[model samples]
Target chain A: MKNPFKFKKEIVNADLFNNDLPLPHSEEYPDEEVIFSVKDFQFYYDNGEKHALKDINLEIFKKKVTAFIGPSGCGKSTLLRCFNRMNDLIDGNKKEGEILYKGTPIDTLNTIQLRSKVGMVFQQPNPFPMSIYNNITYGPKCQGLRNKKSLDKIVYDSLNDVGLYEEVKDQISHSGTSLSGGQQQRLCIARCIAMSPDIILMDEPTSALDPIATLKIEELIRKLKEKYTIIIVTHNMQQAARISDYTAFFML
Target chain B: MEKKNKKINLSYLIERNIKNRKYKDGITNGSTFLFSLLCVVILFLVIGYVLFTGANYLTPGFITSNYSQSSVALRTPKDFVYNENDYDFSDLERFDDTYYSEKWGIGLQYGKDNNQNQVIYLVQMSENSPFHELVRRDDGTNFNIPSDMYLSYITVQTELGTYKTAFSEDGIENMISTLDEAVSIYDSNFLTLGGGISTSLITTCYLILFTLIFSLPLGIGGAIYLGYYAKDNRITRIIRSLVDMSSGIPSIIFGLVGATIFIPFVGSMTGTTGGNIFTGALTMTLILLPTIVKTVEESIKTIPKSMISASLALGASNTETIFKIVLPNSIDGILNAAILGIGRTIGESAALVFALGTFITAAPSFTSGNTTLAVHIWYILAGEYPAYEQACAISIIIFCVVVVLSLSTKLINYLFRRKRER
Candidate 1:
């Protein structure tokens, strides 16, 4: 007798994968106000010899969390990096496109200044190997704040906004690394907030976290959308649907 | 048939197999132990030999002298009266009078003090005749002769008592000079090799300052370019190869380069025939550059690429990112490199020998010849009379300085690593 519980595994056919799909519109929705506009964007690796991103037109709206969901090797991460010109660091990587930030061409803008304006949180909770206080104040200090009071105020306010202030107030001077996974990610969010940027980019922020921490981050993202224009990249479809106001689905 | 054969052979096979395995293991283990023991023994023997030969020259006087006196004994006719003003035998005492050998410049004379102290004078050699044994005669006459030749000790008159002083082949004059100089200067002070105490202190400080000035920025820049700015390609590969080659280049070659390039350039600028402190510093910079570059590059490479990205994303320019995020984060590594560079510069001898000549005097000038502590040891060892004792003392001095610098750098780096970990 055959077991009723046994199921056959289905093989995904490679030929059925689409080379082209409906390109996302460059215009924002009726209620949406465009924060970033990507016009005819194309990215290539190996000095433009290998195309990573095809001609893509899209609009990212302000003060709402947008999630980029895709399978592995789908160019989702690469597309996210283009917003802040983070791709410049990878040698032999080139892009032919216009990524606009608040109606200003991102390519023409000062890269450093542009990065400051568009803050980023990485997949790994990369809290600098320094004290929590320093991690929070690093961006502000770079922008040239000399007063201790101002720095302290910024740190507390940013930490409070990320909902980490109460838990870490007594140990703000302790290393950011000396925290739980969820707390470290929250601290990273606080650090980004301390910079007071117009937009925040996150790449798989909850991928390395457990279910409980992932839920906490998803909630935090929902709250964060009130103040910042947040873009998140996640392989977890449930997390995108739960936290993001607008979702861009991608496949390879 | 198969079952019967298997059952009978089990015990016999097991015992035989165990015995063979044990024998093989014993041979392998024995050979490994022997090789380790041999290596340790050779290493210990080499260290022991170096210490034994090196420390043999150290004497009480060698520890104190500057080793500046001429190596050869200058002789003249007996009619030429020895100057009394140039002699100092303050530490010696005589208790009795006896007939001393005066013919060979060997004898003793003593003068009594109110404290019941007596000053004893045996045959005393001049600054130019450190190796010459001076024997005093019983009648108060003395003879000075070269130490290689036979000389007889003479009985001398003293207020306390007469005692015979041993004829020593080692000259104590350089030891005296060192004491006199050390009393007035710091042991690490390199600024004044020939000058009295104060000048040597100043000279060492100047040398350190000049070396830091010449090496720090250029080294850091080179490291930054290689570690961060330069794209990894053929050009960078060649530059890296050149840097590695430079680090391995013999200091003597650097010295020649320093002498040929820096010495002439500074000499021309100052209208001097010989290079001064400035030229010496320029020479040392080339010698120390590789150390600083390699150390700093290693340190800067330790920084996380993500941190650099975070900084750049925060609107910091490349320069700002380097100065703000990269440098601050890497200060410990940079400091470690600096300490190593300083130590390398200080211990360097042959290179500076040609670049900064080993002429030391009571008062050193920027335009005049100067000697570093290492160069001083070299000259002391190379002299005709070879004041090996003074060289030993100077080596001890260099060793102490290098140890302190290296230890502090290690400590700082360790602390930083711990802090980063925490």
Candidate 2:
């Protein structure tokens, strides 16, 4: 499918592409703790019939926000999915070289354990066809958290963290899909947070949303950096400059 | 001036072309619509005719009563004779005996014989008597009384008077001495004459119940395996094609299979010699599996891949995801398959006749031979005297049941869709 945000790359002078936005510079985080390091990473599709990403090396610092920015078909989202082994679901996909999480090779860790600690939000807000309350508690419940009071607290805190608690408190029992696109994205973020993961991956999470919802998500990411490591893929350069402390550019 | 003229010509040409296309489209569309409407009309007419004809015979007694009635016949003695002076003739009203030449009537009268002992005389009354007329009018014919039979009384009635004339005491004694025994016979009621379908109905219910019980789990399990776990390889592809092909195979073939395989298997288990409801249900299960599996697989496919991914991402196992997410979403399809299966079971006759037997028993046992509603209709129609009225009534009942099943299926689907939307 052709990327819907392809025009954003051509519009260099657009507000979202501004270089003068007030943002935390990466220089201040030079000595921060490194959580993940990629060494000579390579990714392939269809059993190496097609090369998707090549010669990638990068580091994600602890409790810091990192962003990958590029045009469509540049493998930004593909590389982000590699962190949580989401690429394992696709048939005929292969990866070479090493990825380390806290100085341990990621291959040694169980995929389920890796995923629970490294949650992901997709480009579209693909919430399960269930109530908002269940959506938030799904991850926690899967982790064997069954106490009702604890679940309630987790739901309130997660929704509160994404600033959606007040807007949806009256109708929390409503389907998560019934919310607007912005609220749905926030719900997805809240759902990711409820797992209490150490790292959260966002794959163009705001591409399907309006500018207002995008700004809200960027602000949430800025606040979330204090508690969790965040990595986001975006085609909008200014979003990366505004919310991320470190930015890596990919070229097809 | 020339440009303006050309513009007007162009506009006129476009308008003519548009009108011409619309006229052609209308003809094709109208013809197809009329043909479809005609088809629907014909279907309704057939159903209406069945209901109209069968409504006359669909009485409550027809459903509840047994097949035959018990009756007996008694014969009188030949030695008894009538005496004119034995009974009073004062109240007698006489009629011409022109209507009495061949008809004879029997009447019972209590009197004393020659020995002065009380006896009941079986009298052969004359054709001109009131008892003969009463019997003829009620029974639609005259009694065939034998010659030389004795009489104890002759009852005659007229507008002027009523009289009871008796025979001699000696004739009554001889009649009582020579009379023979009474013999019993059973006459079939309306149901035995091909009016009732209670047995067939019960058999159909049994077949549907057991078929579903056997097929649902197997069908759904196979569907889950195919939809979620099976690899998209040559073997799986061949299996899928085989399932599809089996569905298209004539059900009569399945009937043969059931007779050859299921009947013997079930017969051994239940210890019966011939086909029964259990064997028929097993045959139906084989016929229904393809439909159930295909529909459920399709519905499972419709569940978004993202849901599975989301569940897996939440650290849930593959089995957990399948049971909790995939099966729940495919419930509508499962129910739809069951409805279709029921419709097939009810309308099935050729297969069941071979597998379940064609005998309609009043109380069908699981291990005993029986006929379903469809087979019952077939039996009635194929008999020496075709009972179309009762056959049509059974058809009406089957039609109603199928219609109700489909309507309920639609209602459930609609409610599920509405809930999902909410």
Candidate topping lDDT: 2
Candidate 1 chain A weakest ten by summed lDDT = A14-23
DockQ of each: 0.45, 0.40
Residue A86, model 1: lDDT of: 92
Writing each residue's lDDT as its tens digit, candidate 2 over B33-146 gives 999999999998998899998776666544543323222222222222333344343343334421111112234444332223343433345444323222222233434433
Q: What CAPRI grade goes to candidate 2?
A: acceptable
Instruction: Point out the worst 10-residue segment of candidate 2 chain A by lDDT.
Output: A8-17
Q: Per-residue CA lDDT of candidate 1, range A116-197, in tens? A: 6688988888787779998888888887888999999999899889889899989988888899989998888888888888
Candidate 2 regions exceeding 4 Å error are A1-30, B1-27, B62-194
Alpha-carbon lDDT of model 2 = 0.75
Please state the error at residue A213 of candidate 2 in Å. 2.1
Candidate 1 similarity to native, TM-score: 0.72
lDDT of 2 by residue, A101-131 (tens): 7666677667667787788988888888889
What are the runs in model 1 whose C-alpha is more than 4 Å off?
A1-28, A147-149, B1-65, B69-209, B363-365, B402-410
- Predicted model with the maximum TM-score: 2
lDDT for B234 (candidate 2): 74
